[model samples]
Target: MNEQALSVREAIIGRRSVKNFNGQPVDLENINSILEDARWAPTHGLRNPWRFIVAANKEYIKFQDVLKEYGVPKWKELSEEELEKQMKKFRTPGAVVFVVVQEDARQKERLEDYAAASALIQNAMLLAWDQGIGTCWKTPPFIDNPKFREELGVKPGERIMSMLQFGYYDDIPKGRVRTPLEDVVTYYGIEENGEEK
Candidate 1:
Protein backbone atom coordinates (compact mmCIF):
# COMPACT_ATOMS: atom_id res chain seq x y z
CA MET A 1 0.00 0.00 0.00
CA ASN A 2 1.31 3.44 -0.92
CA GLU A 3 0.86 6.02 1.84
CA GLN A 4 -2.38 5.47 3.75
CA ALA A 5 -5.18 3.50 2.15
CA LEU A 6 -8.30 5.54 1.39
CA SER A 7 -11.76 4.55 2.51
CA VAL A 8 -13.81 2.54 0.06
CA ARG A 9 -16.22 5.41 -0.58
CA GLU A 10 -13.33 7.84 -1.08
CA ALA A 11 -11.56 5.53 -3.56
CA ILE A 12 -14.70 4.79 -5.60
CA ILE A 13 -15.72 8.44 -5.84
CA GLY A 14 -12.30 9.96 -6.40
CA ARG A 15 -11.04 7.58 -9.07
CA ARG A 16 -11.16 8.82 -12.68
CA SER A 17 -10.12 7.38 -16.04
CA VAL A 18 -6.78 9.01 -16.81
CA LYS A 19 -6.02 9.30 -20.52
CA ASN A 20 -3.09 11.72 -20.36
CA PHE A 21 -0.02 10.33 -18.64
CA ASN A 22 3.49 11.56 -17.95
CA GLY A 23 6.23 9.30 -19.35
CA GLN A 24 7.64 8.30 -15.97
CA PRO A 25 8.12 4.57 -15.59
CA VAL A 26 5.82 2.73 -13.16
CA ASP A 27 7.42 0.02 -11.05
CA LEU A 28 6.28 -3.51 -11.83
CA GLU A 29 6.27 -4.29 -8.10
CA ASN A 30 3.54 -1.73 -7.44
CA ILE A 31 1.39 -3.20 -10.19
CA ASN A 32 1.86 -6.65 -8.75
CA SER A 33 0.66 -5.45 -5.35
CA ILE A 34 -2.42 -3.85 -6.88
CA LEU A 35 -3.36 -6.99 -8.83
CA GLU A 36 -2.75 -9.13 -5.76
CA ASP A 37 -5.58 -7.29 -4.07
CA ALA A 38 -7.71 -7.02 -7.20
CA ARG A 39 -7.88 -10.78 -7.64
CA TRP A 40 -10.33 -10.89 -4.74
CA ALA A 41 -13.14 -9.69 -7.01
CA PRO A 42 -16.17 -12.01 -7.15
CA THR A 43 -15.76 -14.99 -9.47
CA HIS A 44 -18.79 -17.14 -10.14
CA GLY A 45 -18.29 -20.80 -9.21
CA LEU A 46 -14.77 -19.84 -8.10
CA ARG A 47 -13.77 -19.61 -11.76
CA ASN A 48 -10.97 -17.09 -11.65
CA PRO A 49 -11.32 -16.65 -15.39
CA TRP A 50 -8.87 -13.78 -15.72
CA ARG A 51 -5.18 -13.49 -16.63
CA PHE A 52 -2.92 -10.55 -17.49
CA ILE A 53 0.00 -9.86 -19.84
CA VAL A 54 1.97 -6.97 -18.40
CA ALA A 55 4.49 -4.76 -20.22
CA ALA A 56 6.30 -2.34 -17.97
CA ASN A 57 9.68 -0.72 -17.31
CA LYS A 58 12.24 -1.70 -20.00
CA GLU A 59 9.82 -4.24 -21.47
CA TYR A 60 7.50 -1.35 -22.43
CA ILE A 61 10.10 -0.14 -24.93
CA LYS A 62 10.16 -3.43 -26.80
CA PHE A 63 6.36 -3.67 -26.52
CA GLN A 64 6.16 -0.38 -28.45
CA ASP A 65 7.60 -2.05 -31.54
CA VAL A 66 4.91 -4.72 -31.33
CA LEU A 67 2.23 -2.06 -30.90
CA LYS A 68 3.60 -0.09 -33.81
CA GLU A 69 3.43 -3.14 -36.03
CA TYR A 70 -0.08 -4.20 -35.02
CA GLY A 71 -1.82 -1.24 -33.36
CA VAL A 72 -0.80 1.52 -35.73
CA PRO A 73 -2.31 1.16 -39.18
CA LYS A 74 -0.35 2.01 -42.33
CA TRP A 75 2.62 3.20 -40.30
CA LYS A 76 4.72 2.60 -43.39
CA GLU A 77 3.08 5.59 -45.10
CA LEU A 78 3.28 8.18 -42.32
CA SER A 79 6.07 10.77 -41.91
CA GLU A 80 8.29 10.54 -38.79
CA GLU A 81 6.47 13.45 -37.10
CA GLU A 82 3.05 12.07 -38.03
CA LEU A 83 3.97 8.64 -36.73
CA GLU A 84 5.32 10.09 -33.46
CA LYS A 85 2.07 12.00 -32.86
CA GLN A 86 -0.01 8.93 -33.58
CA MET A 87 2.14 6.78 -31.29
CA LYS A 88 1.97 9.21 -28.36
CA LYS A 89 -1.09 7.51 -26.94
CA PHE A 90 0.78 4.23 -26.80
CA ARG A 91 4.12 5.72 -25.79
CA THR A 92 3.04 7.85 -22.84
CA PRO A 93 1.66 5.14 -20.63
CA GLY A 94 4.34 3.83 -18.25
CA ALA A 95 2.94 0.33 -18.38
CA VAL A 96 0.12 -1.67 -19.91
CA VAL A 97 -1.64 -4.86 -18.90
CA PHE A 98 -3.56 -6.82 -21.47
CA VAL A 99 -6.42 -8.32 -19.52
CA VAL A 100 -7.45 -11.67 -20.94
CA VAL A 101 -10.42 -13.83 -20.01
CA GLN A 102 -11.44 -17.38 -20.84
CA GLU A 103 -14.25 -17.76 -23.38
CA ASP A 104 -16.38 -20.59 -22.08
CA ALA A 105 -18.53 -22.48 -24.58
CA ARG A 106 -21.59 -22.27 -22.38
CA GLN A 107 -23.33 -18.91 -22.69
CA LYS A 108 -24.16 -18.65 -18.98
CA GLU A 109 -20.62 -19.50 -17.87
CA ARG A 110 -19.10 -17.23 -20.48
CA LEU A 111 -21.22 -14.31 -19.33
CA GLU A 112 -20.33 -15.06 -15.74
CA ASP A 113 -16.61 -15.10 -16.59
CA TYR A 114 -16.81 -11.76 -18.39
CA ALA A 115 -18.75 -10.22 -15.52
CA ALA A 116 -16.22 -11.46 -13.00
CA ALA A 117 -13.36 -10.17 -15.15
CA SER A 118 -15.06 -6.77 -15.41
CA ALA A 119 -15.23 -6.59 -11.64
CA LEU A 120 -11.59 -7.60 -11.44
CA ILE A 121 -10.64 -4.79 -13.83
CA GLN A 122 -12.56 -2.29 -11.73
CA ASN A 123 -10.86 -3.60 -8.65
CA ALA A 124 -7.47 -3.12 -10.30
CA MET A 125 -8.32 0.46 -11.37
CA LEU A 126 -9.48 1.44 -7.90
CA LEU A 127 -6.50 -0.20 -6.27
CA ALA A 128 -4.18 1.59 -8.67
CA TRP A 129 -5.88 4.91 -7.93
CA ASP A 130 -5.32 4.42 -4.21
CA GLN A 131 -1.60 4.19 -4.91
CA GLY A 132 -1.58 7.54 -6.76
CA ILE A 133 -1.28 5.73 -10.06
CA GLY A 134 -3.51 6.78 -12.96
CA THR A 135 -5.06 4.12 -15.17
CA CYS A 136 -7.20 3.89 -18.29
CA TRP A 137 -9.20 0.88 -19.46
CA LYS A 138 -8.98 0.79 -23.24
CA THR A 139 -10.47 -1.72 -25.68
CA PRO A 140 -8.67 -0.93 -28.89
CA PRO A 141 -9.74 -2.83 -32.02
CA PHE A 142 -6.24 -4.27 -32.43
CA ILE A 143 -6.86 -6.47 -29.38
CA ASP A 144 -9.07 -8.69 -31.51
CA ASN A 145 -6.79 -8.68 -34.54
CA PRO A 146 -5.67 -12.24 -35.24
CA LYS A 147 -2.04 -11.27 -35.72
CA PHE A 148 -2.10 -9.10 -32.63
CA ARG A 149 -3.67 -11.87 -30.59
CA GLU A 150 -0.99 -14.24 -31.79
CA GLU A 151 1.70 -11.73 -30.86
CA LEU A 152 0.31 -11.59 -27.32
CA GLY A 153 0.00 -15.37 -27.35
CA VAL A 154 -3.76 -15.32 -26.66
CA LYS A 155 -4.73 -18.93 -27.20
CA PRO A 156 -7.96 -20.26 -28.64
CA GLY A 157 -10.99 -19.72 -26.37
CA GLU A 158 -9.35 -16.69 -24.70
CA ARG A 159 -10.24 -13.06 -25.31
CA ILE A 160 -8.52 -9.83 -24.35
CA MET A 161 -10.97 -7.61 -22.48
CA SER A 162 -8.88 -4.50 -21.80
CA MET A 163 -5.64 -2.71 -22.48
CA LEU A 164 -5.19 -1.20 -19.03
CA GLN A 165 -2.64 1.60 -19.11
CA PHE A 166 -1.02 2.90 -15.93
CA GLY A 167 1.30 5.78 -15.14
CA TYR A 168 1.77 9.09 -13.30
CA TYR A 169 -0.03 12.18 -14.58
CA ASP A 170 0.44 15.96 -14.36
CA ASP A 171 -3.25 16.76 -14.02
CA ILE A 172 -6.27 14.94 -12.70
CA PRO A 173 -9.14 15.04 -15.17
CA LYS A 174 -12.38 16.46 -13.77
CA GLY A 175 -15.03 13.99 -12.94
CA ARG A 176 -18.35 14.09 -14.77
CA VAL A 177 -21.61 14.26 -12.90
CA ARG A 178 -23.52 11.01 -12.96
CA THR A 179 -27.22 10.74 -13.77
CA PRO A 180 -29.32 11.71 -10.77
CA LEU A 181 -30.10 8.81 -8.45
CA GLU A 182 -33.79 9.67 -8.40
CA ASP A 183 -33.99 9.34 -12.19
CA VAL A 184 -32.08 6.07 -12.26
CA VAL A 185 -33.54 4.28 -9.25
CA THR A 186 -36.95 2.66 -8.97
CA TYR A 187 -38.72 1.48 -5.83
CA TYR A 188 -40.00 -2.05 -5.80
CA GLY A 189 -43.77 -2.52 -5.15
CA ILE A 190 -44.37 1.13 -6.13
CA GLU A 191 -45.65 2.30 -9.50
CA GLU A 192 -44.07 5.08 -11.57
CA ASN A 193 -46.96 7.29 -10.41
CA GLY A 194 -46.22 6.42 -6.73
CA GLU A 195 -49.12 3.94 -6.39
CA GLU A 196 -48.39 0.87 -4.21
CA LYS A 197 -48.59 -2.57 -5.81
Candidate 2:
Protein backbone atom coordinates (compact mmCIF):
# COMPACT_ATOMS: atom_id res chain seq x y z
CA MET A 1 0.00 0.00 0.00
CA ASN A 2 1.09 3.58 -0.70
CA GLU A 3 1.11 4.81 2.88
CA GLN A 4 1.50 8.40 1.73
CA ALA A 5 -1.90 8.20 0.09
CA LEU A 6 -3.66 7.41 3.37
CA SER A 7 -5.71 10.16 4.96
CA VAL A 8 -4.60 11.34 8.36
CA ARG A 9 -7.96 10.47 9.94
CA GLU A 10 -7.90 6.98 8.51
CA ALA A 11 -4.41 6.37 9.80
CA ILE A 12 -5.28 7.73 13.24
CA ILE A 13 -8.42 5.65 13.64
CA GLY A 14 -6.97 2.48 12.12
CA ARG A 15 -3.79 2.24 14.14
CA ARG A 16 -3.86 -0.44 16.84
CA SER A 17 -1.25 -1.97 19.16
CA VAL A 18 -0.51 -5.46 17.95
CA LYS A 19 0.80 -8.03 20.45
CA ASN A 20 0.82 -11.15 18.34
CA PHE A 21 3.16 -11.20 15.37
CA ASN A 22 3.47 -13.88 12.65
CA GLY A 23 7.26 -13.91 12.76
CA GLN A 24 7.45 -12.27 9.35
CA PRO A 25 10.47 -10.11 8.61
CA VAL A 26 9.93 -6.45 7.84
CA ASP A 27 12.11 -4.86 5.18
CA LEU A 28 14.79 -2.42 6.29
CA GLU A 29 13.71 0.07 3.64
CA ASN A 30 10.19 0.12 5.01
CA ILE A 31 11.46 0.72 8.55
CA ASN A 32 13.63 3.60 7.29
CA SER A 33 10.67 5.06 5.42
CA ILE A 34 8.60 5.04 8.59
CA LEU A 35 11.40 6.77 10.49
CA GLU A 36 11.54 9.37 7.75
CA ASP A 37 7.93 10.21 8.49
CA ALA A 38 8.69 10.44 12.21
CA ARG A 39 11.57 12.82 11.48
CA TRP A 40 9.06 15.49 10.49
CA ALA A 41 7.37 15.66 13.90
CA PRO A 42 7.24 19.15 15.38
CA THR A 43 9.91 20.17 17.89
CA HIS A 44 10.36 23.09 20.25
CA GLY A 45 13.31 25.36 19.38
CA LEU A 46 13.97 22.92 16.55
CA ARG A 47 15.91 20.69 18.97
CA ASN A 48 14.78 17.55 17.12
CA PRO A 49 16.03 15.32 19.94
CA TRP A 50 14.67 11.99 18.77
CA ARG A 51 17.24 9.25 18.09
CA PHE A 52 16.63 5.59 17.14
CA ILE A 53 18.63 2.35 17.23
CA VAL A 54 17.07 -0.41 15.17
CA ALA A 55 17.78 -4.11 15.81
CA ALA A 56 16.52 -6.55 13.23
CA ASN A 57 17.23 -10.08 11.89
CA LYS A 58 20.54 -11.29 13.29
CA GLU A 59 21.04 -8.04 15.13
CA TYR A 60 17.77 -8.60 16.98
CA ILE A 61 19.23 -11.68 18.63
CA LYS A 62 22.16 -9.66 19.89
CA PHE A 63 19.80 -7.02 21.16
CA GLN A 64 17.82 -9.63 23.08
CA ASP A 65 21.03 -11.06 24.48
CA VAL A 66 22.13 -7.68 25.70
CA LEU A 67 18.76 -7.05 27.28
CA LYS A 68 18.81 -10.46 28.93
CA GLU A 69 22.30 -9.96 30.25
CA TYR A 70 21.48 -6.67 31.84
CA GLY A 71 18.07 -7.91 32.93
CA VAL A 72 19.36 -11.00 34.74
CA PRO A 73 20.31 -9.16 37.91
CA LYS A 74 16.74 -8.01 38.25
CA TRP A 75 15.19 -11.30 37.23
CA LYS A 76 17.51 -13.63 39.11
CA GLU A 77 14.78 -14.22 41.65
CA LEU A 78 12.41 -15.60 39.05
CA SER A 79 12.17 -19.39 38.58
CA GLU A 80 13.63 -21.00 35.47
CA GLU A 81 10.18 -21.35 33.86
CA GLU A 82 9.30 -17.74 34.54
CA LEU A 83 12.56 -16.53 33.06
CA GLU A 84 11.97 -18.61 29.95
CA LYS A 85 8.51 -17.13 29.57
CA GLN A 86 9.85 -13.63 29.92
CA MET A 87 12.53 -14.23 27.31
CA LYS A 88 10.00 -15.68 24.88
CA LYS A 89 8.20 -12.35 24.67
CA PHE A 90 11.27 -10.63 23.24
CA ARG A 91 11.99 -13.31 20.67
CA THR A 92 8.97 -12.86 18.42
CA PRO A 93 9.17 -9.29 17.15
CA GLY A 94 10.65 -8.79 13.67
CA ALA A 95 12.43 -5.65 14.79
CA VAL A 96 13.05 -3.58 17.90
CA VAL A 97 13.70 0.16 17.72
CA PHE A 98 15.17 1.94 20.70
CA VAL A 99 13.95 5.52 20.90
CA VAL A 100 16.28 7.82 22.80
CA VAL A 101 16.27 11.50 23.66
CA GLN A 102 19.22 13.76 24.50
CA GLU A 103 18.95 15.27 27.95
CA ASP A 104 18.76 19.05 28.34
CA ALA A 105 19.59 20.69 31.66
CA ARG A 106 16.75 23.19 31.48
CA GLN A 107 13.50 21.65 32.69
CA LYS A 108 11.43 23.29 29.96
CA GLU A 109 13.77 22.13 27.22
CA ARG A 110 13.76 18.60 28.59
CA LEU A 111 9.97 18.47 28.67
CA GLU A 112 9.73 19.92 25.18
CA ASP A 113 12.16 17.35 23.84
CA TYR A 114 10.17 14.54 25.42
CA ALA A 115 6.93 15.90 23.96
CA ALA A 116 8.51 16.15 20.52
CA ALA A 117 9.79 12.60 20.77
CA SER A 118 6.28 11.47 21.71
CA ALA A 119 4.87 13.13 18.62
CA LEU A 120 7.54 11.42 16.56
CA ILE A 121 6.58 8.07 18.07
CA GLN A 122 2.91 8.63 17.29
CA ASN A 123 3.77 9.61 13.73
CA ALA A 124 5.89 6.47 13.36
CA MET A 125 3.08 4.25 14.67
CA LEU A 126 0.55 5.77 12.29
CA LEU A 127 2.90 5.55 9.32
CA ALA A 128 3.73 1.93 10.06
CA TRP A 129 0.02 1.15 10.43
CA ASP A 130 -0.59 2.73 7.04
CA GLN A 131 1.81 0.23 5.53
CA GLY A 132 0.15 -2.74 7.29
CA ILE A 133 2.90 -3.05 9.88
CA GLY A 134 1.94 -3.38 13.54
CA THR A 135 3.82 -1.89 16.48
CA CYS A 136 3.93 -2.03 20.26
CA TRP A 137 5.70 0.80 22.10
CA LYS A 138 6.91 -0.51 25.43
CA THR A 139 8.84 1.24 28.18
CA PRO A 140 9.94 -1.79 30.11
CA PRO A 141 11.35 -1.15 33.57
CA PHE A 142 14.84 -2.11 32.44
CA ILE A 143 14.92 0.77 29.97
CA ASP A 144 15.95 3.09 32.80
CA ASN A 145 18.50 0.75 34.32
CA PRO A 146 21.97 2.27 34.16
CA LYS A 147 23.59 -0.98 33.10
CA PHE A 148 20.96 -1.60 30.41
CA ARG A 149 21.40 1.92 29.11
CA GLU A 150 25.19 1.48 28.96
CA GLU A 151 24.83 -1.88 27.20
CA LEU A 152 22.50 -0.35 24.64
CA GLY A 153 25.07 2.41 23.90
CA VAL A 154 22.90 5.16 25.34
CA LYS A 155 25.22 8.11 25.90
CA PRO A 156 25.85 9.98 29.13
CA GLY A 157 23.45 12.79 28.25
CA GLU A 158 20.78 10.62 26.68
CA ARG A 159 17.87 8.48 27.93
CA ILE A 160 15.99 5.63 26.35
CA MET A 161 12.40 6.75 25.78
CA SER A 162 10.72 3.71 24.32
CA MET A 163 11.28 0.26 22.86
CA LEU A 164 9.08 -0.06 19.75
CA GLN A 165 8.45 -3.58 18.49
CA PHE A 166 7.35 -3.80 14.86
CA GLY A 167 6.24 -6.71 12.71
CA TYR A 168 3.46 -8.21 10.57
CA TYR A 169 0.62 -9.96 12.35
CA ASP A 170 -1.84 -12.66 11.38
CA ASP A 171 -4.81 -10.81 12.89
CA ILE A 172 -5.77 -7.16 13.18
CA PRO A 173 -6.96 -6.47 16.71
CA LYS A 174 -10.15 -4.54 17.39
CA GLY A 175 -10.07 -0.91 18.45
CA ARG A 176 -11.19 0.13 21.92
CA VAL A 177 -13.82 2.75 22.61
CA ARG A 178 -12.78 6.25 23.65
CA THR A 179 -14.49 8.38 26.30
CA PRO A 180 -17.15 10.78 25.08
CA LEU A 181 -16.02 14.30 24.22
CA GLU A 182 -18.39 16.01 26.64
CA ASP A 183 -17.02 14.05 29.58
CA VAL A 184 -13.42 14.97 28.89
CA VAL A 185 -13.70 18.44 27.32
CA THR A 186 -14.45 21.67 29.18
CA TYR A 187 -15.52 24.83 27.38
CA TYR A 188 -14.27 27.72 29.47
CA GLY A 189 -15.46 30.67 27.46
CA ILE A 190 -18.82 29.14 26.70
CA GLU A 191 -19.73 28.95 30.40
CA GLU A 192 -20.90 32.05 32.31
CA ASN A 193 -20.86 32.23 36.15
CA GLY A 194 -20.46 28.45 36.44
CA GLU A 195 -23.51 27.87 34.28
CA GLU A 196 -23.56 26.77 30.62
CA LYS A 197 -24.60 29.53 28.25
Residue pairs of candidate 2 with colliding backbone atoms: none
lDDT of candidate 2 over 125-164, digit per residue (tens): 9999888899999987889988778877899999898999
TM-score of each: 0.95, 0.87
Best-fitting candidate, scored by lDDT: 1
Q: 97-129 in candidate 1: lDDT tens per residue? A: 999999999999999999999999999999999
RMSD of 2: 2.7
Candidate 1 weakest lDDT stretch, 10 residues: 1-10
Go through the candidates in order and give the C-alpha RMSD of each one to the true structure. Answer: 1.3, 2.7
Candidate achieving the largest TM-score = 1
| Candidate 1's TM-score | 0.95
| Deviation of model 2 at 60, angstroms | 1.1
- Backbone clashes in model 2: 0
